[model samples]
Target: MATENNVLLTDTADGVVTLTLNRPDQFNALSEALLAALQDSLAAIAQDDSVRCVVLAANGRAFCAGHDLKQMRANPDQRYYEQLFAQCGRVMQSIVNLPVPVIAKVHGMATAAGCQLVASCDLAIAADTAKFAVSGINVGLFCSTPAVALTRNVSAKKAFEMLMTGQFISADDAAAQGLINHAVPLDQLDAQVDALVQTICAKSPVAVRTGKGMFQRQRVMSLGDAYDYAGQVMAQNMMAEDVAEGIDAFTQKRHPVWKGR
Candidate 1:
């Protein structure tokens, strides 16, 4: 386990790393320091072979309330705002670019950039009582950055409505709209997330890594291009030693011991 000024906490077990945002008093707002901690931690995790999955969790009643509005108001400089937003963008992209899957364990309200954080993850599981919103509109600042992720996770009309009205949606509504994979009772949140983590950990790490990369890369390609790219990736994956071992183990009617290539 590792901790950063008690602002962020990291724990690894059974090939899963859980990063918990620890600023409960601040509602785990993405302050510059917190963002820096997250960025550094994610970069480190990207290079860690022992980790097969990551869970982004929070330690507060509100998962996150987005950027530190009070800090932004204090600075009020265009340059500062630009840098801050850019930093936040990098953090979101890091989650997307991670070789292993990232799951957001949403247990409370995720507003503005917080909502974007959930959307940016590869998968998300939310507690039934959790809420989500791109709520900067209420403060006269358009949630432009969050909208990038919001639109990708949900329909344009639904994204637009949330952006325009700054209304909060229930966790079940988020799941229905494809923003989250599941919405379970608060007490079951940990078990649901753990199930996913365990399943991913049990797979061949190399295949999961290659598949995750292919999934992200193919998302933006034209249909024909996607197929072409996927075919090449699949061909390459087939050549991996792990695949051979997996197939042999299946044919032999026994559990496979993955080498992870």
Candidate 2:
């Protein structure tokens, strides 16, 4: 039997944990319930060292259509929008800051905050039929929340174009712009993501954690400071048992047994 969490379906096996957003009828839009569910899921996974990798997917035609517009329309008040966007920001931050690697599995349209969700992941793979957009501008509302992650993933000029035009872009364009890693046929989406996850999950979890953390933290630092910070991290990682075992295994020509230290 599958153990399901509210707003999400979670399954753990082979060092990989898959978390699927469950509101397919709404294209898995982010509502208060979905946000709360995701927050708790991330927090729980953070505590489980056995979870070496995370696959963020959804059960829907569209991976995510962005924030629940119905909720936004009902609220109307600026304060409601502020609070909702704030929660979206927090969820994105959690995904990026989480210790384990997160891979976004996108199969269809991922617009507005949905695009932000894809960008927030450490890596993303989309299907050939997939489409992406930041179309909030079409409705006279800028996709400010999405801009936060999109700008970091794509070049400044490219990101601005997407935000300003709100035009839909194909999966190929997303990968070329660095917003997504790979794009394959819809039929191959699962295999593609699974292979990518396997490639990452085979690595030493400790090293992966250190590398992911360093990568996330160094993005905004000055070049010199970034190098210095990375050096310190390298030194610290070197002293960890996992690193020592890894090195020894290389010399002995044997598979490394990671202790997750």
On lDDT, the leading prediction is 1
- After superposition, the stretches of candidate 1 with alpha carbons farther than 4 Å from their true spots are none
The lDDT for every candidate, in the order shown, is 0.95, 0.92
Candidate 1 TM-score over all chains jointly: 0.98
lDDT of 1 by residue, 141-252 (tens): 9999999999989999999999999999999999999999999999999999999988998899889999899999999999999999999999999999999999999999
Supply the global lDDT for candidate 1: 0.95
Model 2 ranges off by over 4 Å:
none
lDDT, model 1, position 164: 99
The pairs that clash in candidate 2 are none
Q: lDDT at 61 for candidate 2?
A: 91
| Candidate 2 residue lDDT tens string, 134-237 | 99999999999899999999999999999999999999999999999998999999999988888888888889999999999999999999999999999999
